[model samples]
Target: MGDDTLIDQVRRRYLEVNGDHPMSEADDVYVREHFVEATPEAMALMLEGRLPLPSYLLSDGTPMVPAEHGRLAEIAGGVDRLHDWFVAFWPDDPATAEEEWGHYLSGQYVCLTEVSPVRIRMKTRRVAEASVAVEILRRDPHDPIGRGMLGQAVDGVLAVPGLESFLLPMTAYDRLRFGGPTVRETWVEAPRREFLTPVAPVWPLRTERLLLRPFRPGDEPALTEAWADEDYTSLLLSGTMNPAEVAEMVRRRSEPGDGTFIGLVAEHDGEVVGDSVLILQGTGLSEGEIGWTVMPRHAGRGYATEAARAVLRLAFEHYGLRRVVANLDARNDRSAALCERLGMRREVHRRGDFWSKGTWTDSYEYALLREEWLAQQP
Candidate 1:
């Protein structure tokens, strides 16, 4: 028979004998040379625990199967191995090597046992050989039985030299019900240093006819003018703000704290026409809300809409809010319209939710999730 026919005959015969048994050493070598290059789908099949025995015979007539093929097959069939494959290959492109490593490390399916640096060859400073040995125990990190196995694997790996550097933080595992030491204690002896220096908030979000910025001391005149306007006064908690009160508001907003309150003033041709505030909800929730009001003259120009979008962008991108919510009077159609235009959904409506204009007024709640905001981004 021809080479191709003979190879096919051998593969069929081997499968008939072994059935679904794990791959042998000769099987691995054959796969690397022939199947890996010729039949890439074999890798996926292998990962799924289906090892296709090669049909091709070795030049010396020995069967083509590697010794460790059986163990490799077992590992590949596991959930952790499947997760590692996805982490290594998926997402089309990875930004950095560390990020790629993070993809595998952060996976809920993979149970990492060890990650150690192995020096292959020692030479002069300019030339050396090195490799990383990452030994992992296959288990579902989210499952109870699997989680227990993962803990033992992690502890075993930590005892090995060079593997402790990649150990998961205790707090992280604690949250997930898996345990380990702190990253600092495991990876480094010294305390880590912060890289980015703090800075003041940048402001003055602008549009065709409006400039939105924080309320400064000198903005008292504009604040008094805008706050005293009937259209603006009716929308606010308080009707008016004196110079001292305005100054205090500005000072309090400008001061740095665990949370931030940014008071924004919308200006038209050097005069304040509207105002908005973005306050970080400091109750340990990772979110913020926007409160806004516009003068009667600027009401129909979409300035509030423009400013709110800017604030939303800032909150979603810089502040890292998973969700941002806005609470407005149910009767206030203009504010609700602006929120709707920005893709915020009305999630709640409370009857007699607030005491406004001396009587209880209904409140309409609107919110935009981070995923929604990201989808809307250019």
Candidate 2:
């Protein structure tokens, strides 16, 4: 301690506080096991307190941490102190410490300027400590920025703390400037948070021969025919369809709420030819059952196949469902054929598992997973 300069003083202080905890055996093992794919931001999120990221992210379903995750007291105690220590880890200019330290340590201030040179504006929203949602818009001489000025416009997100991943939904201008054909409109990079988020929309699906949307009152005529048709309903529905019950069902699906089911009416011209339903069978929409009913009058024209494809697109693209299943009466060759056309695997052939139309009916279950769906996509 001979005539310490200010730089030496800061360096000595950081070491005195944090140097005591040289990587323990537990810390070494944790880093060895989990840091194989770890990025700077992910490491920072852990520092900020978002640990136990998603299971799928880890080599195994579980991940090891230095201590109970966010046990940063061993390193620096508080996030701000941790930032100072992180800055010391890399011998960078202390004059630019705040921004550089934030990026290096995964603090609240993340810079994405390197992500694009088109001069894009970034809008970020931290979803709890799990993920951060960002909307990017390109700014030029004439364009108006979305949030704050470029560079440090994280909206004092730096003031808050802890986030696992980020979602960047690019504006059309930004997309053309930064995105390619492979990249969707919204690019989500959550290396630590292992989950799927749909890049598409669930409503107002446009297809070659159909426009799919949530059921409407006027679509009742289409739903009524499909719901009440004995020939079609016998395989899926229980008992006879009462007009009042059918109307209630249509009314319920006409709007979006917490209900277990959402039906999309396939509108052709102004008439409803068929309707598809997605029933939430698993928590967090991990699994969904897609059922479609095209009036017999419109059958065999591939309309049902096209419409069902739209439903599957919504399930996989918009809802980020892990798996979707279509149930068909074993005897219904046409429905089975439709499921086959959509690249679904015949996973289960339940013998008389479903009781329908006063009979114990054998059911065939056709299922598709997200990976398989992606392979099938053009």
Candidate 3:
């Protein structure tokens, strides 16, 4: 090669040492059938690694590479620690030592899948290569185990086999349900490893006399009327909502919040009564704030109290929040009475803490611990 650069020479030598293996017909078929989805680069990587003797093989004759589940790896403190745990649990089999790969793919295949609410049927289909699809019929976010799995799935630590998928608590398995490396399948492209959007606390929460749900378009009329009755007198530079402000409020509440703030509409007898909010705060979302608003005409009926109680339960019971606080104008006796009714302990009575309506106004802060709330539960 005349006048070849040093970089070019190194590249040529590298390719010579690791011979470029052009994609063959069999390789293309294997990739298309095996991976959930693959890029051309990934296919080429698989092809290149084909020559190296794999450390092990699965029952389906698929080569076993070093692989670890994202969440498991995290729990073990690192991939190496996770591998150590695996080795301790799965010692090398003498029978597999005699095989060409010298080991076998051991352990159960565990993954996350979305539970379809519409399909109320649990079905597990096993294919020839052990490819399995489990359909979960019921969607209960309250179940502790199911909640953890859903959280992991949202965090990108757990892989969902498919949307509208099912879940069964994983335990020791006699055989792998999903296909081995030969025909592995997943909805997400493995290499990209994208994370799903974290969702707000589960909703449409109900109390004995009221329904708490997300804001929708048609709710504007009633909500606007409620805002008109709201006394912004004690609030800091805040006033009643105008038409534009009402539209903005509806639009903002309609979009999915980033797991931090949850805005809910309270309904009684098919009429919009008020709104409540749960604001997750502090590190790890360990603490939060609970807020509520009721139309002046509907205030004394205890609609705010009913909805606020449901939201408090959600904070402590569902989200596992350690503490939740509610702050309000100290002069607002209606809200102060509501806090006490909810069993919140008055934590602070800051004097003139807020500069509202061109004057300093006092504020009250009430809080409830998770244990306190749980003990109060019937």
Candidate 4:
């Protein structure tokens, strides 16, 4: 039967309890409250094989099923609704449901629930007996690696039947409920850093005077020539990186790493004059660090300032970061001036706090909030 027909049948079946006097808008709300919301078990059974499984998958390959009517607003609706959703699927133990709900609410643990009879009917359909390989990772509660990664304290896979399996955070609740050696076991795992998936301003981003592109072979000679100069590298932590070292840096930055670095070389009139980067930091990738390096020959031409502005634009506008910061050696007057030109606020200065090049150097931290950056834009 069609979904509409089934919904109508279920509605009628539910409304029958009220005895047909007359149907009104109130009756629809009544059916939802009593039939759909009240008894989750019956709803689960009734909706079995009917509700479509979410085809959208998180970066980690788990299906992206937002709570309550597929809206994030519902998750923020209230704690009561979150609790109801939890008990609906995990009704066996009412004792710890409250705590489990709290964890899910706070994002301490992310619970992927199999709301209805889920069927793997996607591009790569799973066999009837097949099970998905889950990797549960544990990290500090404060450090989140963005969406699709669970922030909980255990990282491994639970072999739930079929390719579609809910990732139950292996907390005390799951250990008590699932009662498996794997569920009870916990591992202090290192942070899983995947290269960030780039979005917006697609690569080869161009401004009026500069073309920002990813590092490619043959660009290293220009980079080495620029970086090898002590005058250019002065006030820099790495000092003068050798030719081979510069090439290695180019290669590493060219490829994706740890979702932290977005490296791009700035091309001016077909010459690689500098490099620009947007470094994502903090949980949810909500903040970023922006930096640029220009060749000595390219200095005093506003290339660094132009490239830094582009990087800031990418951070605030394209990536949707909450804030962007630039940390530079205190003695780097030119860079500090560039930060001011970009409208970044000087937030911190720590004297002799940073040790670099066999000497203690002061550091400066400049920051630009999203609101501030937006205000500066035309």
**lDDT of candidate 4 over 1-378, digit per residue (tens):** 564455455444333322233324443333233222312322232344222222222222222222442233244364335446544544675755555443333222223333321211210122211111122112222222322232111221233232224333333322323344321122112222321233435678888899998787778889888777888777878788899998898888777665468888999989888888888865335678888888888889999888888888888777767789889999989999999999999999989998888889999999998889989889
Whole-model lDDT per candidate: 0.51, 0.53, 0.53, 0.56
Q: Which has the better TM-score: candidate 1, or candidate 3?
A: 3
TM-score to true structure, per model: 0.46, 0.47, 0.49, 0.53
The Cα error of candidate 1 at residue 329, in Å, is 1.5
Give the residue spans of candidate 1 off by over 4 A. Answer: 1-201, 204-209, 242-244, 257-259, 282-285
The whole-model C-alpha lDDT of candidate 1 against the native structure comes to: 0.51
Ten contiguous residues with the weakest lDDT in model 3: 128-137
Better of 1 and 4 by lDDT: 4
lDDT of 3: 0.53
lDDT of 4: 0.56
Error of 2 at 101 (Å): 39
**For residue 231, what is the lDDT in candidate 1?**
70
**What are the per-residue Cα lDDT tens digits for candidate 1 across 1-378?**
454554455555544533433444554453345322213334334323344343223333334332332343355565445435434433554453335443322222111222211110011100110110011112211222222222222222233322123332222322222245433343222111110111235666667777777766676665665655667667555757666776777677656553457678888888777777777652122457888877676678887887788778777776655578899888888888888999999999999978887878889889987889989988
In terms of TM-score, how similar is model 3 to the real structure?
0.49
Ranking by lDDT: 4, 3, 2, 1
Candidate 2 per-residue lDDT, tens place, 154-202, comes to 2123543222122222223222223342122223233111232223254
- Between prediction 1 and prediction 3, which has the larger lDDT? 3
C-alpha RMSD by candidate, in order: 21.0, 16.5, 13.4, 17.7
